[model samples]
Target chain A: MPTINVQMFEGRTLEQKRAFVKAITEAACTTLGSSPESVDVIITDVKKDNWATGGVLWTDKK
Target chain B: MPTINVQMFEGRTLEQKRAFVKAITEAACTTLGSSPESVDVIITDVKKDNWATGGVLWTDKK
Candidate 1:
């Protein structure tokens, strides 16, 4: 089983999550020869303040 | 950047998370030769129903 973990900014809708998992499972099946049932997509919703880029937190970035 | 993603059961305290990240960062530095600042630990708290093994969800397991 291939477990895909994603960390992204919060505020995505349930429908978006549904679409995302479906798309990712399809992509894995096409590229890695994995079955949809064998794919697991775990999504972590991260606050902007928690993520940093180039030493600056996303909340502080313009 | 070494981004370490962890999926575990939910209900962890904030202090636990702090200690866990610190320990993981130190481990990465020791084993992977990665700098503490360059190591990112992202934890995804999973519900029992959301996780499965051996074709059985944790919620259904004995």
Candidate 2:
């Protein structure tokens, strides 16, 4: 099974999640020849304060 | 930097996360020789409906 974990800012609707998982699964199947039934996508909604890039937290941006 | 992503069912406390990250970072440093500051751990809390095993979603189980 191919398990994919995606970390992104929170606030996406359920409709978006449904579309996202469907698209991601299809892409993986087409590109890697993986079966749809074996693909698992886990999406994480990270807080702005919890995420940092270039050693700077997103929440700290002014 | 080594980024490790973990996928598990939701409902863990913040204290658990603090301990988890600390242990995982240490483990990576000891085994892979990666610095703690360079290691990033992202945790994904999955719902039963979003996770499946043996072609059956966990939520669908009765």
Candidate 3:
């Protein structure tokens, strides 16, 4: 079983978010062939300042 | 809003998992004090082989 949780900045349109989720889930399903139900996908949208990678806040990264 | 995604190998009981979630959520709530609805916590249980770190499968690591 494989589950993917995506955390990103909160600005994308609903369609954009849906497409992203669909693509990711399909990739995981096809690559892993995990049960659909077993694959849990959650998207958490946060303020740009809430996330950091490589010691730099995402808001400041760009 | 702070959401924590926890991915781990499967085996823990419901109670154990609930306790873990509760502890994590409470800590996050206290530290971040985000709205309960905004604080989403998702747990993904995977087979040992499905997860890897540092190019090593979790099943083989332990």
Alpha carbon lDDT of residue A33, candidate 2? 91
How would you class the docking of model 2? incorrect
Q: Rank the candidates by TM-score, best first.
A: 2, 1, 3
Identify the CAPRI category of the predicted complex in candidate 1. Answer: incorrect
Off by over 4 Å in 1: B1-6, B9-44, B47-62
Stretches of candidate 3 above 4 Å error?
A: A1-45, A48-62
Instruction: lDDT winner between 2 and 3, please give it.
Output: 2
| RMSD to the hidden true structure, all candidates | 6.8, 6.3, 15.1
| Candidate achieving the largest DockQ | 2
Q: What is the C-alpha lDDT of each candidate?
A: 0.78, 0.79, 0.60
Ten-residue segment with the worst summed lDDT in candidate 3 chain A? A24-33
Candidate 2 regions with alpha-carbon error over 4 angstroms? B1-6, B11-45, B48-62
lDDT by residue (B1-62, candidate 3, tens digit) is 45556565687568666665565455444433345566566777778878776899878985
